[model samples]
Target: MDNRFEVAVSAGTMRSDSSAAVRFPHRWTPGGVTVEADFTGAHLLHLAAAGCVLNDIYREAESLGIDVSGVRVTAAGGFDTTTWQSTGIDYSVEVSSDASADKLAHLLEVVDQVAEIPQAIRAGASVRRASSC
Candidate 1:
C-alpha cells in the first residue's frame, strides 16, 4: 500500500432529516454495473456496503495488473424489519479473465483485506445511533 494513498475514516452525526454527506478523499469506480437501489433511505447502508466492496475489489484487481473486461458483482443484503437489523449480505463476483484459477483465488483473498465494510458486518460490529442528551 502506498503511504500517500492511505486514508482514515471517522464517523459523524447530524440531526435526523438533515443531509450530512460523507466525503472520501478517494473516488470509487462503479465499473459499469447497472444494478441500483432506490427509495430505501437508511436501508441504503447495505447497498453502500456492496458497492464499496465491489469497487475496492475491482481497483485492487487492476492494481495487480489483472485485466477486468467484463467483471460483475452481484451483492444482496436483507434487513429484518422486526428487529430493524441486517440479516446478512452475500457477494457473487464474476471476473472475465484469462488468469489462472490460483491467481484468481488469490485475488479474492486480497480483496477481503482491501474492502472493509463486508468484513466489519461479518464480524458483527454493532452499528447504532448515539445521540447526546
Candidate 2:
C-alpha cells in the first residue's frame, strides 16, 4: 500500500484560517502562518518540508530585497508500507510578489537550494531512540 500524505503551509496573504489546521506565529508575515495537515507521521514529514520552504522563501526574499506578499508551499510523499520507509517527498511553491518574473523564479530557486529541512532530508540521517529512553 502507498502510505501517501500531502500537506500545505501558507503565510501572509496565502494564509487561510478556514481549515482545522493549526495557526502558528511567523516572524516574517504579519498575520503568521497556517499549517494544513493531519496529525500523522507521513503528514508531518510532508508538513516539515512544506513549512521549511515557506519560511525560507520569506527569509531569502528579505535578504534579496524582494517584496514578497505571500507564500504557499505544498509537499507530498509516500512511504513504503512493507518497510515503513519514505518513498521521498516532493514540494511546490506559490508566492505573491511584485518582483519581476525572473526575480521570482530566482528567489524560488534560491529557496529550494537553501531550505534547511529539505537539504537535511536530502542528506539523510540516522534516526533512533535513546537507549535510556
Candidate 3:
C-alpha cells in the first residue's frame, strides 16, 4: 500500500470540526461527513471506497443494534507507472462505538463484505467511453 494514493473520509464524532473542507450530509450521522482527498482520478477512486465503507459502518450498525458514534476509513494503493493500472488497494477502519469489540468487529466485517464500491472494485469493472450525443 502506498501512502501516495491514500484517501480518507470521516463522519460523526470522527469528523474534524475545524477542517475547511465542506461536509456532505450523511444519512447515518447528524454532523455529516468530510472528505480528505484530491480530485485526481486515483484519489477519487480511493475516496469512493473509503466513503462507502464509512457510510456502511453507520448503516449496518443501526440494523445490528450497535451504536456507532464515529467512523474513519482510509484506502490506498499503488499503480504501475507504465500502464497506469492499479497495483491493488488496502484499507483500514477506525471506529468509535460503545459496542463490544466483537460486535464492532462483526460490523466492520459485514461492511467490508457488503460495501458497494469496494465490492465493485474487488470484482473488477470495465471502463469504456460511452458514445453520447
In terms of TM-score, the best-performing candidate is: 2
- Per-residue accuracy of model 1 over 61-95 as CA lDDT, tens digit each: 78887755544555665655666565566666666
Better of 1 and 3 by TM-score: 3
Question: Candidate 1: misplaced stretches above 4 Å?
Answer: 1-33, 41-43, 123-133
Q: Residue 15, candidate 2: how far off, in angstroms?
A: 0.5
Tell me the tens digit of each residue's lDDT in model 3 across 15-130. Answer: 96656565899887888898887788988899889888898888899999998888888899888766778888889999999899999999989998999999999999999988
Give the distance in Å from residue 90's predicted Cα in candidate 1 to where it truly belongs: 1.3
lDDT (Cα, 0-100) at 1 in candidate 1:
15
Question: lDDT: which is higher, 2 or 3?
Answer: 2
In terms of lDDT, which candidate is strongest?
Answer: 2
Full-model lDDT for every candidate: 0.54, 0.90, 0.87
Rank ordering of all candidates by TM-score, starting from the highest: 2, 3, 1
The worst-scoring run of ten residues by lDDT in candidate 3 lies at: 1-10
- Which has the higher lDDT value, candidate number 1 or candidate number 3? 3
Q: What is the per-residue lDDT of model 2 for residues 1-133, given as tens digits with 9 covering 90 to 100?
A: 7777889999988887675968999998888899889899889888988988998998899999999998989999999988878999999999999999999999999998999999999999999887883
RMSD of 3: 2.0
Position 61, candidate 1: lDDT: 74
In model 3, how large is the Cα lDDT of residue 26? 81
* Candidate 3 ranges with C-alpha deviation above 4 Å: 1-3, 18-20
